[model samples]
Every structure is written in C-alpha cells, then in structure tokens.
Target chain A: QNSDASNEPHTVKKSVLATYYHRKFEGRRTSSGAKYRAKKLTAAHRTLPFGTMITVTNPDNGKSVKVKVNDRGPFSRKLAIDLSESAAKEIGIYSKGVAKVKLSYTLE
Target chain B: QNSDASNEPHTVKKSVLATYYHRKFEGRRTSSGAKYRAKKLTAAHRTLPFGTMITVTNPDNGKSVKVKVNDRGPFSRKLAIDLSESAAKEIGIYSKGVAKVKLSYTLE
Candidate 1:
C-alpha cells in the first residue's frame, strides 16, 4: 500500500508497476467492504486516497482506462495499482499479468 | 419504510411513496458507512436487498432514474424509498419533496 502518488499534482502522474486482480477477490469487500465487480471502472491502490480516480494508460497498446481507487493493495514496493479485471483488459494488459502503466490522478 | 415490493416479478412493479435525503446526510454512512456523493446512482430502501437495482419513474414528467440500493431508509412507514438528491432531481421529483413513483427491478 504505497501512497507515493499524491505528493503533488506533479508527482501524481507517473509510470506504475500495475497488475489486475484474480477472480477470487471479486466478492470480497475492501474499504467499504463493498464487493467489486470486474466490469465496474474501479480499482485498488496501496493508497492514493480511496475513490481517487486514476487514468491508466498502456503505452504498448495506446489504450487507457479511468478507474476509481475503491479497494487496496498490490502488496509490494514495486507494484503500484491493482486494476480490476476489466480495467486491466481495457488497456490490453490482462494476460501479461504485470505491465508498466502511466497513472494520472483526477478528482471525479 | 414499507417494502411492498419484491413479492414476485409481477409484484416488482408498483407505485411507491418516495422521498430524498437532505444535503446533511451526504457524508454519513448507512449500510457501508461509506460517504455518499449526490451524483452517484445510489439510494436507500427499507429492505429490498442491498445493491438491488431499482428503476424509479416519475409519471408526471415521464422521466426515470435507475438507482442501486446502497443505503437504508427514510425511516417512515409510509415512505417506501429514499432517493439521493441527484436521483430525486433526475426524475424531476426533488422540488415536490415527496412523490408517488413507479418502481421496477432489474438485475444490473
């Protein structure tokens, strides 16, 4: 749960070691203990403020997905944000397991 | 908090005495205790199963808003559902304070 993303607006956008969650975690709750649906534009971060919106871009595919930080963890110093399955697929990163992503913060 | 809805699919559609929460309730938690944003498509119910999807229709304007049951109630026997302020306004019922609405269920 690294919260290094929000030091400032300048620091908010960076390359992240990102990965998607497995199916077993779907029905479990995180911050609200609310279940996460793979289809929802939501995600988990070590800590960038829950509900913070992050637009993740995959430079390889030139695809992007804007997701809300609703849950927590990738549980590593190297791993930054954990995207939902659909969010990961939105940028063509699901099968790769882990990918470098451009993450930027937004209020909505 | 009348739950006259959901006896069956045939009974899922009915007119309900609906009202919305005041602005003061925005930061408070109901079921999850998660703060609510007025713009989210969410609402409270007496008991229709949490996360249940409800489509509320305002017959006067022929407008409808689809909301998910996330919070819990108006706490009155006569009032059936409590929409969020935005959801109330979406169907043009915010000004009325209270109104009769046709409620329907959907899986999403």
Candidate 2:
C-alpha cells in the first residue's frame, strides 16, 4: 500500500514564506500597469497572470484572505507571494511582518 | 460662490446599478484570461483596466466592499459594475440580486 501511494499522483499543498507590499509603493504603477494601492486586497506573484484571484491562508492562525494578483514579484527566492497591506491584515499577517502561507486556486 | 463652484472642476461621485456574477460562471475564463471564481472579491467593469481595484459602496446601508476589476461588463447600458457573489455579499447586496452603488478609485 505504501508503494502504491508513492506511485500515485499525489497533490501536495505548497507552503511558502509571504511578505507584504510597502506603503511607499502606493500610487506607483505595477508591472501590470495598474496603480498599486496599499489599502486594496491585491498581491504580486512571479508567474500568475494579472487578475488572478488567490486565497492566501495563514496556517498559524487559520486566517485567510482573497487577493488578486496584479503585479510581479517579492524578488526573493524564499518568498512565494507579496500581498498588499490590506491583504496581509485580512489574514492577520500585518502585525507579524511575515508568515508561512498556503496558496490555493480553483481550476477552470 | 455658486458660479465659482460651477466653474471649478468638481468631482461628482457617480451612482449606477450593480449586479453580481452567477455561480455558474465560477470556473469559466474571464476576459482577462483568469478563471472566474464567484466567491472571490472581484468585479467586472467595462472600461477599468484589469487588476484595477475599486471601492463599491451600497449607499442604502452604507456598506462597502473593495473589489478588483478582473473582467468586463454587465453588457447593459444601465449597469455600471458586476460584483462577484462574495463581493456582493460583502456589501449586503447578495440577497437583493442587484443594488445601486457608487464606485470610487484612487488616482496614481
């Protein structure tokens, strides 16, 4: 049974380190051409298309927030998503500065 | 003072009819190529750029929800914005099927 399980196409939930956008970037144009707003629920992902909606969950507190992918990067090899200030707050990560998160998306 | 006010570039908040996306479209592709999820806090605006975030306010109850513009159109001349199911619920419009809302966006 263990060997069969290993051979199966198992879907593992990926966890990544997350950080948030700085207020300094507010009003600046993101790579996708939309002006970044710190108060908006938005995020930056390296490969997700602009307008992609993602659920970012903070495993520590079981809090989660939905953020739209509108810009490009955290630029750090260690991070997976860069959320806006409001997005981070929604998931209880604003006060912490950073958190380990699991990302989820629905397939079409 | 009235003449001066008339001459000034006065910004008037526009109010329009708003509706929510149906759950049947949950996994379909939006105009921006991202998959639509009815539970996400997103909206469809005719002219707004993809990824633009707008504050949708339901003036009757003074409730509001921030939504990202990810798709296009109510396709009706009378409607201004179409919220996702969750967005509609956030602003207390989900049960009504439609609501009159004021749209606001910040300039860069």
Candidate 3:
C-alpha cells in the first residue's frame, strides 16, 4: 500500500541479509528459520569478518545505528542485514516498517 | 569504579524501569524478567498510556531512536527505558555501555 520505491536506482548486489527487513512485513522465515525481531541492532550478512562494525542510517530520518557483525546470515542475493525492531525504531523507520538505509562498514 | 556519577545532581525520581539500563552493566536482574533480549525495541515502563511513542537520544553521539511503550516495568526508582544492546550500539553507546539520553513523548 506504499509507493516509496523510487530511490532504488543503484540496486547494488547485497547478501541474503540485505532484504531481511522485508520479512517482518511479509512474514518470511529466517534461514535457521527462527522468528526474527525487527527491533534489535542485529543483522544478517553473507560473509563479513566477525566483530566488524556496520553503521546503518535511515535516509529519511537521518537516524543512524551501529551494528556489530556477529554471526553469518543466510546467503542470499537480496538482503544485507536483518535489523531488530528496536533498531528500526531508533532510526524512526519502524512505523513505516521499511526504510532505504545506508549501510557502511567501519573498521574497529 | 567509574567517574560518570557526577551528573546525578538533578536526579529525578523515576519508576521501576527508570534505572533499568544499569542492570546490564551491573549484572542486575529484571523483575519477573526472563532473560530479555537487549536488541529488541520492547521496553519496561512504570505507567504511561499504552501505545505512547517515546524518543530516546544518545547524548554522546546524538544517536536517537523512537520506541513504543508496551508493558509496565518494575516499580523502582532508578531506570527509565532499558535499551536493547542493539539500540545502544545504534546510538554508539553500547561499548561505553551507558549513556545519558533525552527522553520525550510525541503524540501519535
């Protein structure tokens, strides 16, 4: 019911976790296939060195969050990281439930 | 063991949930709180109307997040919102583990 898909021009290739946020609204299951929360700062990735710090910012609200790459994510081509619901709310994206955020890796 | 206690000059009397964030660093337990996930947006509160929206900002990095008041918290006099570990990370406070943040309520 929303038409906020105009700025997806870049279409960069991401891992399975890239599109993880869509699961909350779509009721999709995780790879280990357990229920995921959209409020945490946790994210899924194809393969990132563990302990890597990732900064995610909501383009609309300018809310930024730093996430530590902990475990591996289900390898896919669409998603990058699966954010916890609280993490989304911190960046003001939880209400809309989906946001186009900037994902950058910051070395520790 | 820490010198961050100087800001307690105007300590306000908050409900049970007010001093919640300290639990993680202090290894304190929550009331009836089964091992809670620090990554979720869920928060424990004293008494605010349900569905109220609250804005929490990390004073250090200026990172901010919006949270929905869901359940009532332990009736203590120290903590406010117990942020998930992920939420703290987003605001750049997880490593330090504690932050002084501004809390505001916004009408929906």
Candidate 4:
C-alpha cells in the first residue's frame, strides 16, 4: 500500500540519556570550529549533521529547549547525547548532570 | 616626551568582578541578535561595543580566557562584567559563580 509517507508527521522523536558538556572544556574549539560555550543552546550528537536543530525535553519535568547540533559525541555508549550546560539547564538537567530526555527533530 | 603612545602596549587592562549569566537566559536573543549561549566564550558589558574581544584573567589562579562582548548588562553596581558560563569556567569562575577578574582589551 503506497500511501504518501510525506503526509505523515515528519517530526522524529526519541528518548535518550542526556548529559552536559564539562565546564573545563569551555573556550576550546569544537569540531565545528566554533569555540565550545557551556552557555549556548547547542549539543553534540554522534551522527547528526552540524546545524541540525532538535528539541530536547526532560521527561521528568516536561521542560524542553531547542538546540542546534554543532559538535559530536557523548563518547560513552550509554549516553545518546551530550548537551551544552545551557541546553541541559533548559531541559532541567543542569544540576543533576544528566537526565532522560525526549529528542524531537523535524525535517525541513 | 611623547615618544610613541601607540607602541607602548595599547592593551587596556582592568580588574573587575565578573559573573556568569543565568542559565535560564540560554537560547534567549542577545543584544547582538544572536542567541545567548552560556557555552560560548561571549560576554555582556555595560558599554563595550559588540564583538570587542577581551581577555579575562582570574586573579586568584592566573587562569585566563578570551571572550567577545556581545551584549549589554551587568546591571549590578558591584559587577563590572557578565560572562557566559563557559567564559566563567574558562577563567575558573564557574564553580564559584563570581570572581575578581582582570580584563584586558587590545586596541586595533
């Protein structure tokens, strides 16, 4: 049944463990050539293209923040995303260090 | 004896209290029209022009970081500069939340 797939919701959502960037790493250049700022709403993903925008929501508090994927990696196999401190804070994970987050991305 | 004012180290340096931006402000629009990122090496000052690069040094530890002025702030009478979390972290202020910093600006 060749139904139109384009008509379906294009937003991709997933659940993953989200952690923040180390504060010590701030000012260091990122893989994207932009210096890492723990205060920016940006994140590092294993494979997402740079500039990819994602909405990360903390399942515990329902708070969400939009971030641009500008770098790569959580490095650990268990964590799916590494967020900047600001991004983590927006989703209520700044103090806890890590949290389970729902990631949503829409196709442009 | 006006020998050479231009050659006599045109870098202006000052000691001021530097604080980090509130994490809640991440993703908000900065005065420069760019989103405020606590993770970027950016800062807010009461009068510095946007994009003015300044070097911030921690007097207690001697650690330093370079940041660009991108917003206007530090409304507090005691604080002279407002740094992003990453900027603060770079100069060893992230953990303490505030610090006595040496600010140096070089003129072109």
Please provide TM-scores, in order, for all candidate models, with all chains considered together: 0.32, 0.32, 0.22, 0.34
What lDDT does candidate 3 reach at residue B34?
Answer: 32
In the predicted model 2, the residue pairs found to clash are none
lDDT (10s digit) by residue, model 2, range B1-108:
123334444332345445455445668776567887755767665445577665555444444556676765544333323333333344444455444543322111
TM-score of model 3 (CA atoms) = 0.22
Instruction: Tell me the docking grade of candidate 1.
Output: incorrect
Instruction: Give model 1's TM-score versus the native structure.
Output: 0.32
Model 2: docking quality category:
incorrect
lDDT of 4 by residue, B9-52 (tens): 44455554444566777897664568888887676654355667
Of 1 and 2, the candidate ranking higher by lDDT: 2
Better of 1 and 2 by DockQ: 2
**On residues A1-108, what C-alpha lDDT tens digit does candidate 4 reach at each position?**
224356553445555444456567678765466887878867665445567666655444444556676654544333333333434443344465434443322111
C-alpha RMSD by candidate, in order = 23.1, 21.2, 20.5, 21.0
DockQ of all candidate complexes: 0.02, 0.02, 0.06, 0.04
For every candidate, what share of the true interface contacts is present?
0.00, 0.00, 0.07, 0.04
Residue B84, candidate 2: Cα error in Å is 31
B56-81 in candidate 3: lDDT tens per residue? 44333456555544434432223222
Which interface RMSD values do the candidates have, in the order shown? 24.8, 22.1, 21.1, 21.7
lDDT of 2: 0.50
Model 2 chain A is weakest, by summed lDDT over 10 consecutive residues, at: A99-108
Return the candidate ranking by lDDT, descending. Answer: 4, 2, 1, 3
True contacts kept of 4: 0.04
Candidate 2 structure, TM-score to reference: 0.32
Q: Is the docking of candidate 4 incorrect, acceptable, medium or high quality?
A: incorrect
Give lDDT tens digits, candidate 1, residues B1-108.
335454443334555444454555556555545566554656555435566666555454444556666654434334433333333344444456545544322111
